[model samples]
Target: MVNAPSGISGEASLEDRIARKARELGFVACGIASAAEDPVRAERLEQWLGEGHHGSMEWMETRLAHRRSPQGLWAAARSVIALGMSYAPAHDPFALEEVGDHARISVYAQGKDYHDVVKKRLKALARWLVAEQPGAQVKVFVDTAPVMEKPLGEAAGIGWQGKHTNLVSREHGSWLFLGAIYTTLDLAPAEPHRDSCGSCRACLDVCPTDAFPAPYRLDARRCISYLTIEHKGPVPEDLRAGLGNRIYGCDDCLAVCPWNKFASRAAAMQDFLPRPELVAPRLAELLALDDAGFRALFSGSPIKRIGRDRFVRNCLYAAGNSGDAALVGPCEALADDPDPVVADAARWALERLTSAP
Candidate 1:
């Protein structure tokens, strides 16, 4: 193994210490990027934002300068340590879609929220860096921050962003959760990874909603993942049928990638293992969840963020498409739900059920 350069102390060279601690903390890959201007990246971000591709995620527009370039976040920051943790599932994620009566929650949201899991590890690494450097200042972030993690990961040599706009690692495929630690310590940077998605349009073609307007560009309004999970109000009628049983985020784009053949199931990270109930929950069962029931079911999972009303709204859409008259009772029950969004979706599902051939 290539060791850190001579004379570097405080456990070891920053890179060696970080790599060791990260491995102990369950990270699959770690890399460093020296803080510098990212003009081309800034331009691309500005263009994407100008095009309003972020949909209702208005926060993406608030910290334009800080998000596009790390130097803007912290003036003295010398390096950004990017980390990736694998959440690869043991079974094919797409297989769950065939179960007609069940809702297909995304694999990543099957267990404890990754933002919490990855953030804890990132903070641990940050703590180690502070202890080692004594005077070093560090700020750690998971997806909770305005940081452009994919681009930073690319600059740090973790992986290149695939056409689907997710970071794709050679070893972990597209099943990695990213986190970062910005520090005042100067660390040698790794060579950036090149995009290996050559000629593969599988991700784009597989989207049921045609979310991708072009390669490497996504229209969040048309994205099933965004429609089901991110959009708080009623889901658009046109996209509901295409959403099928996916009541949370959609994974068709990632599932179709050929690179996934090389992916390995993540080692037992308790936070990533699926709850038996969430694996293939019945649409009627999920639609029956009131506020308390929804809270109880998704207590530790990322799906909890959508809350009971939004979640039931999504389930209602799936119930409509399920074409199972059994689900019609649950859909009608929710038609008068207190939440307008839930009520509207239930009414729509009830209508679809009634009109079915």
Candidate 2:
């Protein structure tokens, strides 16, 4: 037999019950936070956007108000359940840094799209909660909406958003996939996660592009993850070399956190297992992909979201940085690609390779 809260009906503590259910659903971390105003987060968001740090992701600016408060986004949402799934790698994500001729994809993109994986589980958890709490309203969200997941995650005790501006879990490390469940059931909130980053500057100093304008803040325009996946046009010439062989997203910051020591010893999820081909793909092979080839190769993967043009555009930059004379042939082949951005990247890559000593 279970006991209910003073007004809500449930046998177990709402927070405990939901957290256990979330773990059963494969989430490594779960906590709840009130769906109320977060003035400091709102102000930080406004300042970040006001400085034009979001780059071409104009949606962030448009959805500013919605992101400030969960209740504002959904008028009836009284509590928020923040969740995190570990995509922790079995080995060091930085180990491939010396592999000049191979494209190093972000560790998170090495497997199935996390958005699909996380959202499916979030929906399952939300459905269970709704069924358990009669007359309660609920909404689920992953990275797709205006939800300020990181701050909410912090408030909910999932983890603190570290110097890299990505959530860091003492137990799960920096490689986490976050999701949220908003409800009107008045669930109990958890103790907020403490800021454990301390004096560690490893994540900040490791950035090849120096993307951080300050501790705990990011300028997305200078972020390689943003440039490869979100920016539509040519990459800035100055930053191209800094990208190294990172063809999709950069994980330099996330990979360097000291908390990752705990993650390597933790259970690794099969859903995040790297596809053999994606582990360290040859730059030459990536550059050879046509649209059809690109789609088929990255199907059911997050890399597909960037589409062929952007994916290949990233490949071109890696090719230029590769310094492998053999890739010049493939680079030249894409110089006349149908997409202007791809063509520009190809020309730039060819120039770099041709001018190599």
Candidate 3:
């Protein structure tokens, strides 16, 4: 166990002590939030879901009750400790835009799976909390459960939910990986971060598919990140061109946020540094990934969960948009893919590439 700093042992409150310990444990940001229900947050979620903005993510609907509040998930959880780990990229997220032969990957998915990385640290923090105060029960979550992590993150002062419907920190911008610890102990809540996006339309304007219906409201159906990674079939034909070179996830909105100017690239952990091959992978190469090949390539990556077919489907979409005739051979090979969805995408890419002058 790492000991506290020399003079900080005399701190007045336990929350302060715990927060200091959280910093020591590698959390870039840490704050407290109550377990009580937040009516506004709940109503907003209900509205988002009611509007079908969540697209095909049915789990949000099924877990509505438990997700509305921390107490709803665990009655004994008196306070929630929100933590953020920075994965801010050290390089430009838009570097591959003109490089048509290559594919663009979201910064978040270009390295080790964040679910595993964040959860491990969350568990370690939870264990430390338990050991510090014997019998203290804690539950840690990192996007796995029904928990509404974004709103809770905002309430905990980690950052406010921006117009892109993603958390944006004044310090770290849109580069945080959030996690939470629900504990039986009642801790003083931090002041909630107010919406700082005032008059800023950068994120909204940068979205190629116009995913945002309005400021702070996203229609996931049109989001490239949702389409490439979550939508399970051939993408909507109308939106295919907008996907461009983004083969896995989209970063346009996040990359354009003015707040990102404040983010420090050096603060990013080594675990999230983009792998050399994944940094700017050739679209043709990605279009050739077989199931086993895809599995090996993305072995510890979040992209693997979407499977080879979906991945290739995305690469094909990029190929069609690439305007690079060299990808035609690879696109032709997958026109009869076993997965009907991948086959459909291949046929579509052939039409685009062949039709172009």
Candidate 4:
């Protein structure tokens, strides 16, 4: 076990020691940043929400002050220890796009839930940091918290928020899962990473749904990941066909980033490895999953969060776009589902499939 240094002097040494410990605990990258509110980012967020970019996820509007500023989340926090774990895929995540009638789950959701995987490590690191500084209060956050992790990560030198509105690390590409440990300790901050995404509109151009209205800004309503995952009820009529075979979170933007050339195929953590069953799930099979079967298949994965109804709704959209006769029977069966939203999506999908040339 790597031990924290005794009587560590100066901020730089302590920062180094902490970063080393984070690496020892399996984090691919680690850094620290002052725990102050970022007015610039706050303004951007306010404008984005005002424009209804958040869509049905009204939670983004709640505790607006806290979501914009780390200080609002925890007044006592003097520094934020940002950490990242790589879930880089071996092959291009977009490679499976052409596989007709197969469901394309996001690269990140192909295995275990990242919140479960990242939070455990964050807690472990927070405990170590608390022990090292005695009396220093610490709180760890994953995606569940109101904390703005991406900006904090950029401030901590982990990466820059790319045009796609997600953190882009040169070393880890667009595949890093972020976590934070807010602490009262005044740890030395790392040099902030400058935006390296200049002139690269690959992420924006690649979005199937034109989710990015501008660089570094996303209108989540049109995002396939949002439509397929966060969205409840039937998807908008015009966008269902654009969903194609994506039945979970969409990775088109992330996968197209040029920085991903540096990403490794194998994830450092075993839990992030893709499950063979989820890699290219048959639309017919996925549409037929009942609550029990859905739970069993996605036992430890993030996909289970949306439940059977939403998942099947997404699958139906894919089936509608597939133009394959094999999936028509399943779509017809689900058109009469008990869940009104699923039934609606089924009918829409069936109509599209049956109408296809």
Candidate 5:
């Protein structure tokens, strides 16, 4: 454990102590940024929202001011500590797509819910800070918050936000899960990192739905991650065909990044290991899961948040794209699901199956 400098007591400098503690807590990288104006990002976010690119994630619009600048959220906040953990998978995520009958869950969703894992660690770090300096105030945030974590992570030097709009680190590649700790104490800010993705259009070219309108700008409406996780009702018919076998979030952008070749495998956190059934689940079997079965199977996983209806809806699409007539039965069975969205997707899948020669 790294200790504060002699004679400093609670007034010890934050740089060395915090970095050492973050490493001990298993964070791959930690960086600090003073809460300040981000004019460029503010303009970009406003433009993205004006174009209605966020789809049904209305919350993005609700916290526009705070999302663009952290100081807007907490006036007392002096420093934003951005932390990242590696969630790299042992196998290539793209490989699962080749198995026509199986559903492909994004690498991030294959393990335990990252919200829980990252939050626990963030809270621990926050508590440590407060313990070291009595009366210190702090707040922690994961993806649930309205904060623009990607830009903050970038500003903090943890990584650069890639063209796909997710933060990418050279050390961890694009496989990092980000969390933030906002503290009232002033901390030495780290130098922001420069973008290393020069001339690399791999992520842009690989997106099936063409979500990127330009480098670093994403139209989430067309993003599979938004379709499967955020968009509530029927997925736009035009995008369904491009969804391929993905039943949760899409990883084409992240998977195709050349930086990922250097990504480390899953950390020692066993909670991140793929659940036996989730690794390459049969689309037919997944579509057959009832509400109770779905809840039971995804009890500890991030997929549970989508619930059975949306999950089955996603499975229905994958089933349709499987090109295997064997999945027809499950699709047909789900055509009358109690949830209108699920039933509607099932109908669409059935049509695709029947229409196929």
Candidate 6:
């Protein structure tokens, strides 16, 4: 049973009211979990980090204390509110795989940076919650925080962590953007979402680089998304071919999950709708972008955070895999790029493109 907010009770229960408000604010799912520490979640994170699966994201290890639990980050936190906003795509993310001349940005990154969108919604929810129960202190966190959002998401019954190490909703599938609100107000924890990925190897099988060492395990070093976005300098030689035409993030694992069959495009918040230019961007155009051009093109995009150099380097990798000789002229221009990484990627792409049988 949900604890109704103080001096506020009529018909709808507290959980129902919050759920309705979250839905009204564009979140598709909302659930509450106790802010108490979970040894299992903490241990798993320690194990994952110990295994070096985080790649070059050194911040994960640096902020290990706060990441262990909601309370670890904020001492007075008594309840955790988890929310999910749908970003489910209307089209298949893998459709561009055979269309090499075009770049394949991940479905999630094609829209405005989700960090801004989700955080705004989270703050709104927190504001409403505070107003409902005066003096109930709150702090909100999206992906930027060291919080264990997925585990909190699971604990709050938002979704279960799937084999791909991403939270999967039966309703939204792998297409939800998650955020959390830690409040000093105590609320009953929702029943945890049970694992439902049973007997399905689709997410693992679809990985182009075999990034998953086993079910429910990911080696980020071998992950195309990590290599393209997080890793600096040149990509490992063996993994470049696996990148294919994917210039930004990869969606292979998320796209193949059968649970997404239930995902609805209509459920997605308007903020997540793909921009026309990002949908089927050509490699030739992206490969030709200079710093100013890159900044202007991706002004409000998540891609902008990776900066012009990293993004161009990714485009070069895609160009190398494109088999489109027309991109050669653009790649040649970047061969002496100011950034060493971009220049290296250009040379690598040139070799692969010219030497291709």
Candidate with the larger TM-score of 2 and 5 = 2
lDDT of each: 0.85, 0.88, 0.90, 0.86, 0.86, 0.91
- Worst lDDT window (10 residues) for model 2? 1-10
Which tens-of-lDDT digit does each residue in 103-167 have in candidate 2? Answer: 89998999999999989999999999888888888899999999999999999988999999999
Let me know the TM-score candidate 1 reaches against the reference structure. Answer: 0.95
Model 6, range 261-322, lDDT digits (tens) per residue? 99999999888889999999988888888889999999889999999899999999999998
The alpha-carbon deviation from the true structure for residue 150 of candidate 2, after best TM-score superposition, in angstroms, is 0.5
C-alpha lDDT of residue 172 in model 4: 83
Off by over 4 Å in 2: 1-11, 264-266
| Model 6 worst lDDT run, 10 consecutive residues | 1-10
- Evaluated at residue 171, the lDDT of candidate 3 is 91
Better of 1 and 5 by lDDT: 5
> What TM-scores do the predictions have?
0.95, 0.96, 0.96, 0.95, 0.95, 0.97
Give a tens-digit lDDT track for model 3, residues 1-357. 112233456654667677777877777888889999999999999999999999999999998999889999999999999888899998899988989999999999999999998898899889988998898999999998988888998998889999898988999999999999999997788889899999989999999998998998999999999999899977999999999999889989999999999999877777888899999998878887899999999999999999998999999999999888999999999999989999999999999999999
Q: After superposing candidate 3 on the true structure, give the runs of residues whose Cα lies further than 4 Å from its correct spot.
A: 1-12
Candidate 5, lDDT over the whole model: 0.86
Could you give me the TM-score of model 3 versus the true structure?
0.96
Please estimate how well model 2 matches the true structure, expressed as its whole-model Cα lDDT: 0.88
Q: Give the local distance difference test score of model 4.
A: 0.86
3 or 5, which is superior by TM-score?
Answer: 3
Tens digits of per-residue lDDT, candidate 5, 251-303, equal: 88998888887777855356678787888999888988998999999998888
